[model samples]
Target chain A: MIASVGNVLVWMVWVGAATACLASGIAVVTLTNPFFSALGLIGNLSSLAVLYLLASAEFVAAAQVLVYAGAVMVMFLFVIAYLGGRADAPWAGGSKLFRIAAVVTGGALLAETLVALLWKSSRLSHSAAVGPTFGSPAEIGRSFLTDHLLAFEVTSIVLLVAAIGGVVLGIQPSPEEETTA
Target chain B: MSALFLAATTEPWWISLIKAAIIINIVLVTFAYLTLAERKIMGRMQLRYGPNRAGPFGLLQPIADLVKLVRKESFFPAAAIDVLYIFSPFIAAFAALSTFSVIPWGPGWHIGGYYVTGYVANVPIALILIFAVGSIGIYGFIVGGWSSDSKYALLGSMRTCAQLVSYEVSLALSVLGVVIMSRSLSLVDIVDRQYHEWWYLPYAVPQFVGFVVFMLAGTAETARAPFDLPEAEQELVAGYHTEYGGMRFGLFTMAEYINLITLSGLAVTLFLGGWHIPGPWLQAYGPIWFLLKLGALIFVFIWMRATLPRLRYDQLMRFGWKVLLPVATLNAVITAIVVVAV
Candidate 1:
């Protein structure tokens, strides 16, 4: 009876988080204000983090909030605030053809997701059993060092290159400034 | 009387709820008195009596302040975004309050036939969880400033955003040394490792560099004096919450103090061997020791505020990125190498 109650609670949480994720994801694109859109994105990321916690991937869940919802979104808010009145609404002036293309692409992705969900649900009645240390930091660190070593190194290099690119872009003289110089 | 000891994971849900209730109240009371203490201490430093009129030695100051704040008219700026302007303080307070949940206040003890852990929740990634919740707290300042529709508020939030983001890197990096030595991210495990180590010394000795960087970065992260560029009063007129009044403003203040308390608690847990006394005979009074250490760290925070002048904006940025970040990174690297070798 206790196990059944626990299962019911877990299901309730999963459903609530999933619904919030979808709602916020839609809100991100639908919101007129840039700040609101960013807020929506944060909401979406946070709800997704909740889902990750529900899945018992505690490290990934925390990283999702720390890196994306926290650091990256703050930067986005910073830029939006800096731009202030000049920041235009997303896709506000896009061509009709572009909007159509975006819709088509979104529809395709949604269909693919639905199909995959159905396929997976048919194959497995419950989530696959994970080992005791499956999502622990130590296990994750070991996996990154051994099984995913190359991928990990590549990711670091990519991040380094991105940082350099950002610095270069930031230092570049604007067109008007260059002409004067 | 039967007694049963339970691990953090095995404890029942109601027990966790009880722990949460107790912790929240304790933290809130501490926060209320901390404001009073800060004022009194600062007043003493500057050669003035602070709030002596309120309930003898200003014991009732916090209560009086609460009453005034609650009763005051909550003035909203005409151009402010209503939804976010109102929601931002709660967001900030929520982040600050939740970060305390994972902080283990003491070693677990059996009480009345039940084993109760020190913390509300003992997740595997408790350390990262604190940072994650803290990051969310940044949004409160940012959103509050933006929603207020004031340039001063906007600039304040911008400064807050940049300062916090820059300092967080060094702050997280500085703790890597401790995580390496302990080989676990859980606060309880870290404290346990410190207690059980052969030398009986906290990580503060071996990872002194990390400890210094952690404290410096923590000061910046909490936006206290010397690093409080975001709310530099002369420049920004109270910064992000310039337009906020009444309880709305009070919430922001509450969040800041709570975050300060949480940071001190974390420092004690990470560097000072939380709740661990040198002698085995004093083990039963673990919570008292924990509180004593936590209070000392908080006093240091207030002392720093009284002592140091605020840093210049450019100096703040330069110090965080150039000096603190490099020192933290280098310390982490050296610690990792030494750990691997020995």
Candidate 2:
């Protein structure tokens, strides 16, 4: 009885979080104001993090909130605020071709999702069994260091390159200064 | 009730709920008194009585302030974004309150059939969760400022975002040494390791550099004095919440104080041996030791506010990125090497 109750609670949480994630994802694209759109994106990211938590991926869930919703979205808000009232609505003035391409891409994604859901529906019934410590920080750290060591190192190097590129771009001399030099 | 008192790990939902309710009330009451305590301490430091009229040594000042704030007119800006402007404070307060849940305040014990764990939740990633929730709390300030439609608020929010995001890196990095020594992200485990393996010595002794970096970064992360560029009232005229009035404004301040208390609690848990005294005899009085240590940290926070001046924006940025970040990284690297060797 207790196990059933726990299962029900988990199911309820998953449903609630999934609904919120979908609603917020829609709101991100549909919101007209740039700032509100950013807020919607944050909401979406946060709900996605909740979903990650529900999936028992605790470390990933925390990192999602800490990195994307916390740091990256704050930068997005900063840029939006810097633009002030002059920031354009995301979908307002795109070219007709661009809009067509967007619609086509969205349609393709929808169709692909439908195909995956219907054709692979049987696969969703059973999940792979794992240890209780799966998705924990220690477990993830161990896997990253051992099994995925090369990939992890490559990712770090890529991040380092991005940081260096950002600094270089930020420190470039103005045209007038360059001419004077 | 006896049946419900299972092991801490297997406690029923209602038990967790009860614990959460108790913890929330304790935190809220502490936050209320912390304001008065800050004022009284500041007054004494500056040689004057602070709010003596509010019922003897300003004991009732927080209640008075609450009543005044609730009764005051909540002025809404004409140009403000209504939904987000109002929602931001709740988000801020909620995030601040939730971050405390995973913080273990004492060692677990059994009384008859009742097992009580100090924290509401024993999250494996409690340390990371604190930073995560804190990041979400930043939204309250940023969104509040952005929605206010005021220049000062906008600028203040911008500084808050930049400062918080920048300092958070160093703050998280500074705790790497602790994580390395304890070999766990759980606060309970960290405290347990400190008590057992380290022979009652906290990580603060071996990881002195990390402790200093953590304290500095924590102060900056919470946007306290000497690093309070976000709400530098001398220039920004109340900063991000300039347009906020009444209970909304009160919520923002409440969130700030609660975050301060939570940070202090975290510092105690991480660097002050948590609820453990040096001897085995006083182990039963865990909560009292925890409270005393927590109070000392809070006092240090207030004392720093009274003693130090706020940093200039450039200096703040440079210090965070250049000094704190590099030092924290170096400390982490050395600690990792030492941990591996020994």
Candidate 3:
């Protein structure tokens, strides 16, 4: 009885989270308020965090909550606040084109989901045999060090460029803006 | 409701709920007091008296402050983004509190002769899940800043995003040294690795480097001292929190402390063997010893905040990528060699 009740509650939270995520996705695109748009993104992101914990990816889950939700969101909020008083450039009338594009994209997404559902049986048998690589952090580490070494190398280059870019962007126009004004 | 009650009636269920509540309370209280201790310690270091008047050397200051905050009027900004603004605090608090769930609090506290291990989940990827939670938590800041409708708040949010993303790379890489050396991500298994040959000393030189880098980056990720450009008072005027007041402000402060606790705990776990008490013949009370170790770790964070100056924004960026990033990658490479060669 206890197990059954616990299971039910867990399922409820899972389903509720999925619904919230869907709602957030809709709200992000539909909302006029930039504030509401960011908020919706938070909801979607946080649900993904819970889903990580549920899936037994504990380290990734915690990292998700900390880096993405905790830290990145804070930065996103800063941009919103810093730009708060500034009005956005007026929207041009490509929304009808956007609607037509949305229809094409939406139809494609629907067709993809439908195909995914139809392909479930064939895909099930064809799924790659995952090794006993789940629990071992060392395996993940080795993978990072070996097979993903090129990616690792590129990650360093990206970070180096990003650091330089950040400093450059952070610079205030070489005192040129100040002199002109 | 009654269904919950019905589930609560199971013998083990009753104990489980009790244990959960106790753990949760312990984590929350630790967070609350750590802030006061940090403030007081930093105050003394800065040649000023901290909050020493409230109760017997200001120990009760957190409690007193909590009461005042609770009574204060929560001023919701009129132009606020509604849903996310109202509940971002809860989300922040929840994420901080949940990170403790996988922690092996104590070696299976005995109950009725069936050795009950004191952990909520013993998954293989507990460490990864912990990191994942941190990732999700970034949204709270973004949401809070946007919802506030303040320029300062938004700028702080953007800084937070950039800081966390940069620092997280170094932070994650630094830990690869330990994970490779120890061969497990499970905190339990990591502790077991320490039993025979201590991880700290064998890879002492590299581990220390990793530890320092992780601490520096982690502190920035948590928006703490030295890397607190996001919330720099003179600059952004409280950064993302420029608009919050009362308990809403209180919640943000509470979240900071919680983040501090989580970072310290992670440090202790990864570099310090978490709750694995040092010294032999004292392993029985390893749990108590572990708490003491964590306490000591938290104390040092406070000490650093008191002593160090905040980093310049450019310097902060440089330190992470130029210095820490390459060193961390080197540590990972060396660790892989050591593991494979062995």
Per-model TM-score versus the true fold = 0.95, 0.95, 0.79
Q: Each candidate's chain A: what TM-score?
A: 0.88, 0.89, 0.73
Give each candidate's fraction of reference contacts reproduced.
0.63, 0.61, 0.57
Q: DockQ of each model against the real complex?
A: 0.51, 0.52, 0.33
Question: What's the CA error at residue B278 for candidate 1, in Å?
Answer: 2.3
Better of 1 and 3 by TM-score: 1
- What tens-digit string does per-residue lDDT give for candidate 3 at A1-181? 9668866976787788788878988987776656556667776777786665445444455556666655566556556555652355433437688889989999999999888888785875443544444314556567788989999889999999998999899987758788998
Query: Roughly what TM-score does model 3 have, to 2 decimal places?
Result: 0.79
Identify the runs in model 3 with alpha carbons over 4 angstroms from their true place. Answer: A1-14, A38-102, A115-181, B1-14, B46-49, B197-206
Q: Is candidate 1 or candidate 2 better by DockQ?
A: 2
List the candidate numbers ranked by lDDT, top first. 1, 2, 3
Q: Which tens-of-lDDT digit does each residue in B175-217 have in candidate 2?
A: 9999999999988899999999988899899989999999999
- On DockQ, the leading prediction is 2
- Clashing residue pairs in candidate 1, if any? none
Kindly list the per-residue Cα lDDT of model 2 for residues A4-38, writing each as its tens digit. Answer: 77678778878998998999899888878888888
The residue-by-residue lDDT of candidate 1 on B1-342, one tens digit each, is: 000111244787788888888999999999999999999999999999888888988899999999999999998999998999999999999999989988887778888899987778776788998999999999999999999999999999999999999999999999999999999998888988898983567888888999999999999999999788888999999999999999999999999999999999999999988888765667767889889999999889899999999999999999998899999999999999999999
